[model samples]
Target: MVFSKKRSFTMLAALLMVSLLLSACSGSKTDSSTAAETDKASDSKTLTIMAETSSHADAFKSIIPDFEEKYGVKVNVVEMPYDQYQQHLKLKFISDQAEFDLAYVPIGWVPEFQLADYITPIATEQAKLDELELDDFPGIDNAYFGADKQLYFLPYMNETHGILYRTDLFEDAAEKKAFQDKYGYELQPPQTMQQYKDIAEFFTRPDENLYGVTLMGENSILSGFGFYNRLFNYGGDLYDSNYKQQFNNEAGLNALNDFKELFQYASPAAKQYGWSDASSEFLQGRSAMAEMATTVAQMAQDPNQSTIVGKVGFTAIPANDANTSDIKRFYLPYGFVMTKNSDNQEAAFQWLEFATSQEMMEKAAPVGNIPARTSALTGKLASEYSFYKPHADIMNSFRLETLPLIPEGSTITGEILPNAVVKYMFGERSAEDALKEAATEFDELMKSRGY
Candidate 1:
């Protein structure tokens, strides 16, 4: 479906303008444009960055020693788990107790941060952005702009969701012949839901101690990412155009039902699996397939952590054969944003400049990073890695857009929606009821905020 970028960008400010800031942690933001840097980055001896513990963070982080020697500054990094990252950053910023100079922001949090005025508008850094060739990164975040059309962060890495499976198993002569005889179809990467299910079931051999898939069923925003991949595949969104909650309908039900089916083929312990857990299952060669954020799945390429490095194969998420829908693949942008209340804005910008430079992006690429740079994606790495072309195709797709942007976005995905999804997966509720509960609660929140 054509998710209207223009439409969403226009709605960004209007949707978030009325969000009530936390009164307990009230603080003022610096006026970066006209004011002098609170501490000149050049004079600052130390810089602190808050990052989530992920490949994205490690890409730039592993090379920080080079930055320190070049700039002569100490860089201290605080890493948080994905589940805790949001709340921790929010409390830190809203309470006026933030010590972070810059943090790599996920796309979902940009609107909330902008609406709450927790970050500085970095329009003044246009020169640095130009030097870094900002256009080299995916432009999805540009369509999520606020009323001022200002950028609040620097883009570093972008990724989308796609399927990863074992090529070794799929290509095995004996296994393929057996799969063909039993399933009556070629045993290759899944292109249809029925094929996906059959292959998942085929690979599920309990005696071999291997399951079919690594289904991440964690009860957090990770579930949102997991569920929304299915939701988007079925042409479902969190809300309809009228600001009405419509996900309790057919598309939503179908997406949620996917989990119940996938559950049968994944590890019984997958009931509690997060992305990290799910990837581990696949990396250790214990599971056959996993739909992963493109960059996260790059872990399969690491010889240190992965037993199935060369065996891994990548593909787009398969669709239900009945629904001839053009899906928007799950995509997100991660980048560094300077906190308005930070004491080290100047140094943070310097770090951003260094991290996103073309040279640095290329450097990060070889170090197990899916760098968000045009050159990196289109360069020799595209031929070196099996997934780079697919990743680039999703980014360059005209249909590419972001997930819904609203002030209550975090609550909808992180809490309400995922909770209901988990309940449905555990058979605590029917698909309809679970989605209804989530959609209703989301509507109430938006209404209370005057959306």
Candidate 2:
């Protein structure tokens, strides 16, 4: 499942938001009605889950039969593209036509869903909580547990944003020697912003129709995600601790300028790229590297969808080592949540428990679904799945955060800041002016929402 431009975590014009799941082989566009082939067993109850198209759909297929057999529930995952899914769900709720018992929600949407009273907390006994093995998820309490001590969301899939590069190119003798001779250092994955640009410039070759990196510049939200990720990389934030606008300053300016500079080494078509487009450019061997989700990085090893299998490597995105936060990872927790209108909350919670169980996650990992469980992400499974170890290490050791889980979070995400960055990149406005204007818009939005 390549990313969409619509939702933030769709790992979306993904900055400031996201909702993506496994990579290109996911057949993420499959019809909901056919997602699961339910048995025609007598006296079986049916539960419908509103979800985005994902390889998780494929992973879930393998577990549905077992869950159905044990629970006597026939599950139907009603799927849609991430770009349209958010508005679709909002309309569903507004019209009271939200018939699904459960939904796969982008964590960024949690606040809006909460403020709108659209979902119910997953109320359960201590025994059930213990059975869920909640401790297996590192960020669960901060992300989904409410002040009232009720669980509000269940994360089935989660990810970190990082760099994906061509290992064969990095490891090539001729290339490494040339790079070292030219740059005066070992040719390796970048640890700082300068190294990233340096590596990109070295690999860029227009005559060969290749470039240093593939980037997302089209689709405001998608581009916004790209810009924001850069902003995050430089110890910049959309807002400061007091919730004041702060991305117009030094670090933000650096993030914006650095984002524009990368375009110089990307394909001219880079200006029109989104996550999926950039992903394809990297996967098809058109570029040396790409900044994408850990989930997307897994596809680099899939023989069916990648040309660089056994020749790809993933790592944390580049940051200025001297000036950055310990949180090198971008948080994209796309998972399932129980809907308030559901008449089958208990059964839905049961599904959430069974689906996120350690057993099921380990089963799902091989199919490209990154498990949220601690055990599933380490030891044996981590060894088998190349993407898991880096992601697991980041999750366990680092502090991660997403966009403001506020009712107004959606309005701030997707385009406002990214569009501004693009205007500056196009020479239509000065960087200072563009950021100042965007920051003004951000502050106005917060005020209008009574934040």
The prediction achieving the highest TM-score against the true structure is: 2
Candidate 2 per-residue lDDT, tens place, 1-451, comes to 6545555344434532322333343344345444432321222367778877777666766788889898988788778887878888888888986777888877888877776788888666788778788888867874564556577787777778777888899999999999999999989988887898899999999899789988888846667766776777766787766679868888778888888888998999999887778888898999988877876677777888888887878877766663444644457887777789887777888888888998888887678688888777874677667777777755654557765676666667676787787888888889999999998999888788676
Report how far off residue 144 is in candidate 1 (Å).
Answer: 5.3
Please list the C-alpha lDDT of all candidates, in the order they appear.
0.76, 0.77
Q: How much does each candidate deviate from the true structure in C-alpha RMSD?
A: 13.3, 10.8
Alpha-carbon runs more than 4 Å astray in model 2? 1-44, 145-149, 322-328, 396-398
lDDT of 1 at 85: 80
lDDT of 2 at 102: 86
Question: Candidate 1 at 126: error in angstroms?
Answer: 4.7
Kindly state the number of residue pairs that clash in model 1.
0
lDDT of 2 at 139: 78
TM-score: model 1 vs. ground truth: 0.84
Model 1 lDDT per residue over 1-451, tens place = 6559988876775566544433223323223211223333444667777777777777887789889888876677767677678778888888886766787778778888888888886546567656656666777356335787777867788777777889898899999999999988889988877788899999998789899987878898777777776787677877777778757788889888886788899889988998768888889898888867776568888898899878887876766653434666546777877788776667777787788877777778767678777787888677778888877766655256665667677788788889989999988998888988887798788899887
Off by over 4 Å in 1: 1-43, 140-144, 321-325
